[model samples]
Target chain A: MSFTMTKHGNVVVVDVDGQLIVGNRQELKQKVLDELEKGERKFLIDFARTGYIDSSGLGVLVSLSKKIREQAGELRLADLNDDLKTLFELTKLDTLFQIADNRDRGLESF
Target chain B: MAPVRERWPSAAGSTGDPAGPDAVRLALQLEVPTDVRLIGRIVQLVSRQARELEFPAAICSLNVPVALSEALSNAMLRGNKEDPAKRVRIRVMVDPAGLVMEITDEGRGFDLETCTQDPTTPANVVREDGRGLFLMRRLTDRVERYTEAHGLARNVVRLTIKRPPPADGS
Candidate 1:
């Protein structure tokens, strides 16, 4: 239900705490869009603390990815649990985003 | 908000219980306004009930929450159009076989065949909206939609998830 932003080198890591679904998806979108407006382009969404994400959460991620790409920026995701990994795979979004094993790897990749 | 309504089946109807003849079927029903914020609480309630009924961890923790959230949000946003006067009715039945949930929304039904597009398709991957139905179908064992015409016409989404066979092949 919370999104915490931090900077590591050029990557702006957004850590998602708690489940991401319809109720709070708009907050996440606004936060990321605000960061995008500030010219912070390289983004990594860390999901280590995230319990789960419903379809609305996934939609926001897709929308954010598209927006970031339009601005010539990149977005990556890391630390998704097994269930979440399966979700991305099932939706075929695994191919659309660059996913890393952890935050460290995600930062390095950027 | 109106209080949740629950109904339990009588013991005499347990003749074909999946667990045993003595098993009692559990049911929970709720009617909430068309609000997205209530999705989490409802999901938690159903998830806890599934766990208490000895459903598998995967189904209790992930599948049920994700699929139920989708169904509820769909009912609130698309079915009911976020009408404040409208309400979403949820009924859950849990037995040893699995869980069955019915979500009824007070709205005219749409054609699921025409509305639900494959979100995985290359053209639709970035659409950001059409994946709810796809995820619900993929995560649950069954997803069915139908319209009820008694009084006000409404749409019902019935989802089912069955318990897997025991590991020892029992």
Candidate 2:
């Protein structure tokens, strides 16, 4: 998977493209952690183009969310399609993360 | 030794299609390393075949792939411990009845009954691990775990998903 990071005001939007499976989940996790380490918080992950995600990918997201929350930083998700929304709901992660319908909404939440 | 085809009578009975006209059976075997990329590739290949057989996108693209990914990861990562010297064997069968995928790893077997945890609990919700087996059970129609006594004991995870009828009513 590939990620493009762009600044939308104070919130950093990371657009993840392709499937987020075990093979490439660490890349996303590392990037998020690096941003966190650099003191850049208020993150929004854009999943509009992502087609699929396994439990491994969810684990990465969970870790990222926890790390950011622990540091008093905010993390939000945007543009999750039906399949992804269902996945999060099934795993009960929807209750743990702040999800928005679009990028603007995700940015506005922070 | 001849290839053994141990039909899952339980799965057949569940689908209520012991032998139907639309039941076409095909089996594929692959020996892959403990690489996640290779596992994804294998799942993609089988998913394409599932699509060609008129499986719905929800099943072929989403449900099957998710279940297969979790099962394969467990076999390759946890079971084989990412040992390149060890190989993971994947056996896939698609028939009118449904789809059956068996992933065998060259690791000591574990009890399937003990592989579950409550992911919805408050304490486990934020954890980054321990959700693979849960996802596998949720996404597939049936999941069976056992050990095969070959030269060395192999951990086998069998997943079965029934094919949905065509949307166009064909």
Candidate 3:
């Protein structure tokens, strides 16, 4: 999977393109962590092009959420399809995350 | 007997009742080292086979791939402890009814009852490690574990998902 980052006001919109599974989850974590280190706090991950995500991908998201929260920043997810939405619901992460219907909403929330 | 590492064509030419005379069944076995990189390739191969066999699009695209990736990761990381010498064995059986996959890892197995906790609970929502087994159980219809004792004891996670009956009338 690849990450395309764009700046909309203060929020950094990260577009994940392709499946985010075990193979490349760490890359995502590291990228977000690096961004956090650079003082980019408000973050939104756009899953419009993401096809699939496994447990590892979920784990990375959780860790990133926790890390971002610990830094007094925020993280949001947007554009999750039905299958992806179901995954978050089943894992109870939906309650933990501020998920938006689309990128604009996600950016606005931050 | 060594596990055959090959893909076998469908025993029955048509997708029908597995027990019926014209039942369709495809089998594949793979033995690979403890490498996380191979997980995607294996998931893709299985997902493609399921789609070609006419499994539901959701199952072929999302459910199977997610469940299989979790199982494979568990086998490689937790079961084998990432030992390069150890191998993970996969056996896949697909029929018109559904799919059954057995992931065998050459390591001491743990009790699934005690090992896995509800990741969705308030207490464990932020925990990163336990969700793999939970997702495996959630996405698939059946998630079972058994230890084979023929030569060496090996832990096998058997995942099964049955095809849902068609919607009412037309």
Candidate 1 residue B60 C-alpha distance from true site, Å: 1.4
Off by over 4 Å in 2: B1-17, B20-22, B165-170
Q: What is the DockQ score of candidate 2, to 2 decimals?
A: 0.74
The i-RMS of candidate 2 is: 1.0
Compute the lDDT of residue B160 as modeled in candidate 3: 88
How do the residues A1-110 of candidate 1 rate in per-residue lDDT, one tens digit apiece?
78999989888899999889999999999999999999999999999998789989999999999999999999999999988998999999998889999999998897
Cα error, residue A45 of model 3, in Å, equals 0.6
The numbered model that scores best in lDDT is 1
By lDDT, highest first, what's the ranking? 1, 3, 2
Model 1 ranges with Cα > 4 A deviation: B1-20, B149-151
**lDDT, candidate 1, at B20:** 62
Sort all candidates by DockQ, best to worst.
Answer: 1, 3, 2
For each candidate, what's the DockQ?
A: 0.79, 0.74, 0.79
List of clashing residue pairs for candidate 2: B23-B96
Quality class of the docking in candidate 2, CAPRI style: medium
For candidate 3, list the clashing residue pairs, or say none: none
lDDT of 2 by residue, B54-162 (tens): 7777888788888999988999898999888889998888877678889999887678888789797999998898888888888898899888876778999999897
Give the distance in Å from residue A75's predicted Cα in candidate 2 to where it truly belongs: 0.6
Worst 10 residues of 3 chain A by lDDT: A101-110
For model 2, residues A1-110, the per-residue Cα lDDT tens digits are: 69889988888899989889999898999998998899898899999999789989999999898899899998899999988988999889999999999998888888
